[model samples]
Target: MEELMFCYQCEQTIGGKGCTKAGNCGKDAEVAALQDLLVYQLKGIGFLGNEILKQGKNIDKEISKFVQDACFSTLTNVNFDPERFVEYLNKSQKIKENLKTLLGNVPANAPECVNYTIPASKDEMLKDAKKAGIMYDQNLDMNIRSLRETLIYGLKGMAAYAHHAHVLGFYDNDVDNFFYKAFASTIDNKLSVDDLFNLIMEFGKVNLKCMELLDKANTQTYGNPVPTPVLITKKKGPFIIVSGHDLKDLHELLIQTEGKGINIYTHGEMLPAHGYPELKRFKHLIGNYGGAWQNQQNEFDNIPGCILMTTNCLQKPRDSYKDRIFTTSIVGWPDVQHIREIDGKKDFTPIINKALELGGFTEDEPEKTILVGFGHNTVLSLADKILDAVKKGQIRHFFLIGGCDGARPGRNYYTEIAQKAPKDTIILTLACGKYRFNKLDFGSIGEFPRLLDVGQCNDSYSAIKIAQGLADALGCGINDLPLSLILSWYEQKAVCILLTLLSLGIKNIYLGPTLPAFISPDVLQVLIDKFNIKPISTADAELKTILG
Candidate 1:
């Protein structure tokens, strides 16, 4: 018998509640437990880093990368292969041991290693979990539990962004210290909901700095983005579709396939490639191939191209398309091809050759085109014009209605908000969240499209830049601008983005599609009082509240 595994990381598990038998996520109990162990070990390392920081020692880039990788390994769909999971666990242990040596002290070690040959039964694992970490006390009330989980989840998101930034050679000491502090707090016995709430807001603040760092790295390296149009049709030749959030991998693929006759199409969060000047300059960069990440299974079925996934948001592969999928960076599955460590600038010749072998569409298919490239640079370049229009009452409100999208039924609220919004308003969006309404014909305002896609979730950095620039253009603070942020969050990246918003003291923001399951009432109230945060209501109610 295939031993059952239990998990409940997402909204669409086995039930709306959680996965009790096998993980609705397709993770077995053993893998789930190991992931938890990995998180626990990370918390221990975080504690070590915190101690070192208080002693006035700074963590180096190598240690910071290890910490961030630990957090990322626990993401919903990142690592499912048993061997990879074990490798991740062993690496985390090695890092922890190395950190201990660097600090000249030893902290707590993980529980006894599990016997992989004879898997521990679910009951045994559950019992072992009771002694896991600082946040494991059953006596703690709901408020405390909720607050700790909230911070952990927020950290999980921050770690993901941190990992991506690390990939591009970016690091922040203060951000790294806070990560340790927060992780240590979860294990601290003295923490309260009030304490955790303050920490939650602090998480937001640090995320701002992190996002800003990534923005600088990206724009400085790739040049500021400009407006461009992307096509939605497959060409009748050899091609490759690169998805996910890592631009380094995409840059390498573009370089390797320079004259190989293999066209490259950006998919999922990558569709915004139309914006960046450096990436957009690639003539063979071609256009987009499909819709949001969720629909990729069907889109890839019988598709004649090689697909390179560089990060999260991968679904189970179909047999027809399995052999064609290639993953790099930390993204991995049990039986898929994974490319590790670039041998001098990442030769994507393997992926390019696969594309040529598969060919592509038999005929030049009619394509659907959409306008993109609305990053901070593009928006700031038009700031004077936008401000002039706003002053003339030509442009009234700005709605930042963007976030992650799941199979949740309540997500229609975004569509309604966009449709019911005032005619003079602009809808700025990023990430998978925009899929709810990106196809809508909101018409253009002056020379700009009514609905603008800045980039992926990390590109929320672009939205922040545009907001701050607009504020400066109008000689006001961001909060004083005619902008209302209605954000929908479904995963860790959303959590980190929310933290960045709060960190900036940008208040009166509305968040929803259902608030996080990890926040207790006391913790939630703290956020409400400090940030004026509120759960999203119906379009009629929220619009009245924001516009009335």
Candidate 2:
């Protein structure tokens, strides 16, 4: 058999077997190598950026854009197109060159970016690529390697979000500078796990600023989100389902198709659309399409409508629905229609026409409703009711059982934790992992439902807001409150969200579904010693630990 699929990113990747050739999710050798190269280049630039910052020089917007572009490009399921990968590499290299010249110094010409098929004489390329990838300690023990991987992966996720925020005109110099420092430090063999772990926490801290920028971008641009229910039934005409995570793209589409016959439905992480005010205001903006990210292939197969992916979490499309897919921004799949950015605004008229031509479901299907619209504003508005419930002994605890999910059987642990959580404890979740139990009716403690679905993966910002709000209401610090965070991570976004939590100095977080492959042992120990990070064990055991 030809070796085309191999990957080590998420758990349950091909029988938990290391993907030695190609990723099962359509990632090939070229994409993998380029992603690694982009990461390494970011590290090199990041290190250099830190030096500039040390000398009291702030990297200019052009330089920062390159760093952000590198991070955003490497996010899982984002830039899978080879051509685009090359484009990003050239742009990144130019930024590095420009930055070096701007600072009156010069670094060597970067090696060629990684390509799909290895060249005949790849010894130098392979060596450079591997070195750039920043392997930690061929001489170190296993644990340090794992911990370093975890922290690095988390930063990758943070970088993606930070990049998005940066694009929206929000830039934090401290955060930007740290990006360089962290990437540069990875290349240094003298660094200890303690140093890396501290960096991990720093990643979390900077991520908060990044997330805050996004939260502002979304809320200010879209108005504070309110509770709005979404319907599962497709209206009786042609429509489109837009997946991935770009709110600006969604808003533009809503504007582009304002009076058209096409309707818009959200899918995967995009399900939280029903909660945003500006998006919900669109008359044609209908409800959600499928369940979570994992079900996209089955859900979209043979469906008559078009699918527009604005960001990551795209699986390889089946032939049945291949013709129906369109991608914009960083999300790409081979041979799919890509909506390009024009004059800083994406014109999606083509997408709308395609959806109309495809037509929709054969009939007005039976409508099913899924509850949503429980964003931070909605939760905070009910603070009095929640506080009253607690006073009346109607509520006992709060559990933020949220994060990305994977195919690993161990992921069932999240479901168990949510299922076994005290009946009086409220479960606040975001990202695709909520699919494990989002449909469960745990009954409300007073008027508050047992589970609150806060928008998409990026909406982890909402959960943090709620946690801080509750802490303020009780006149105590966030950690002192009776709130527990049980996170299950699968991808880089999860890594960033975890970092934001750590940056806040939030401790005793329980994380699982297998610690990251990138974290080194020494890093893990530092996390354990400093912040009491624990792996997810049995739900019963973990629940007891959280409660006690």
Candidate 3:
């Protein structure tokens, strides 16, 4: 049989041997091949775009948006439709072709990526994609290949954030230029391993900027997140469930559904929407209904309302609820009704009508509330009290257990850690990983809550700021503080965040549920030796080791 597509970009690849026949995330060979082709064409566009920038010429804003969308579309589980990938690939080729004309002749020594041509048909594209799989670099030096792949994955995460921020009317020329530079560098075979390693670090720095841009966009548009309690139960009424990371979509949905008797509930990463003042003002905006993205297959299986996915971490819909699933932005699944904007407005009437038809729960389900929006500003506001508690032995340590959540069995370790943490310890959590234990009551340590939610994955910026504030206030290095970072990673976003941490010279981080499959043994040793990053063992043992 012909060799199948290979993809191991996420934490869970089949047996760590790469997904040869089908992705563990429900992506088949066809979608995988098309995604690979899309990435290749993106690189071609990046090469041309970068060359234009080097000449001090401004690249078109639309081209930058195209690159960002294409990169985001290739993220795990975001888009499984082959046709969507084909469309992105063709658009990328058109951008590159247009740039070539405007920028004049190319150098004879240019890399093959700069001269690459898009296949004219879907059949031809699939045939060409076979040669573009990530495994094509397998024969290269192991260390060099590892660094290159790391940089590429980091760029993917950065692109996702940049795209989100761009949609919200925020744009940074430095961030956009770095995307082109990083993409162009990936195809340059002449770069030494050390060069690629430096590029990886540089990408980390730019990723920090990207995250900061997103943080500003979110805060300025929605107001600084304040600590708010979000209900985990559904109300009795027509309701719509909004999932993913797009606050803009949630805001719009809340506006359109207001006073229409259709309640709005947050799901997955959208849970934090309740903390923003602009969003919480909507009376019909109810609370969250589900946990992390991985739990959606079961949580959304028979939901009584329409669900709208606005970004990444979306799984293939089951037949039971597929009819009620609506996708927007770069997210796409075959047969699902996709909502798009025309004249700068999105008509959510179909989703709203579906919710009214379902008639929601018979009565309000009584449930516990989870606290969210303990971002840096909110956390630091209580810093003086927290410091007093720590000095008085009321608070012993701070554990930052945050990152992406996945379906692997070991993910239970996060829940176990949260449960097993002593009462004297305060937990700082972020991203979707908090869902594992956020619903539980950890009680309080003096005036400070035991658990603090710091927004989404990008809010790692806030977590870092909080840590630095503590370090500065105490007049000690960050390493000397009584803090432990036990993070769980499953996607490129997590990878970029980890790189940012390491780039800041932070050490002794505990990473789990498993290490990335792309890290070679030698590369892993470099990380282990330099940063003291360790894979998590049993929660009890790990906790003892950390506290001791």
Consecutive 10-residue window with the lowest summed lDDT within model 1? 110-119
The number of clashing residue pairs in model 1 is 3
User: Where does model 1 exceed 4 Å of error?
Assistant: 1-17, 107-136, 342-345
lDDT score, candidate 2: 0.75
Candidate with more favorable, higher lDDT: 1 or 3: 3
Q: Which of 1 and 2 is ahead in TM-score?
A: 1
Best model per TM-score: 3
Residue-by-residue lDDT tens digits, candidate 2, 1-548: 74432346665456554565776666887777667766766766765676677778767876776777667767677777876766666676666666666556534542232112222333433444554443323575555455555656666676667666665677777766777777766656567766766767777777787788778877777788776667876678888898888877888888888888788898887888778877888988887887777778889999888999988888888999888899987778778889998778787877788788887866777877768878888899999889888878788888888888666678888888889988878888888888888777788776777988887778888899988999999899999988888888877888778777877888999988787655555666766887899888899998887777
Position 32, candidate 2: lDDT: 73
lDDT per residue as tens, model 1, 60-98: 778778778867767776666666666766676676666
Q: Give the TM-score of candidate 1.
A: 0.91
TM-score of each: 0.91, 0.90, 0.98
lDDT of 3: 0.87
Query: If both were scored by lDDT, which would come out higher, candidate 2 or candidate 3?
Result: 3
Tens-digit lDDT track of model 3 for 134-233: 8776677877767877888888888889988998999999899988888888788889877987778788888888888998999999898998988888
Q: Give me the runs in candidate 2 sitting further than 4 Å from their true place.
A: 1-7, 13-18, 106-148, 420-422, 540-548
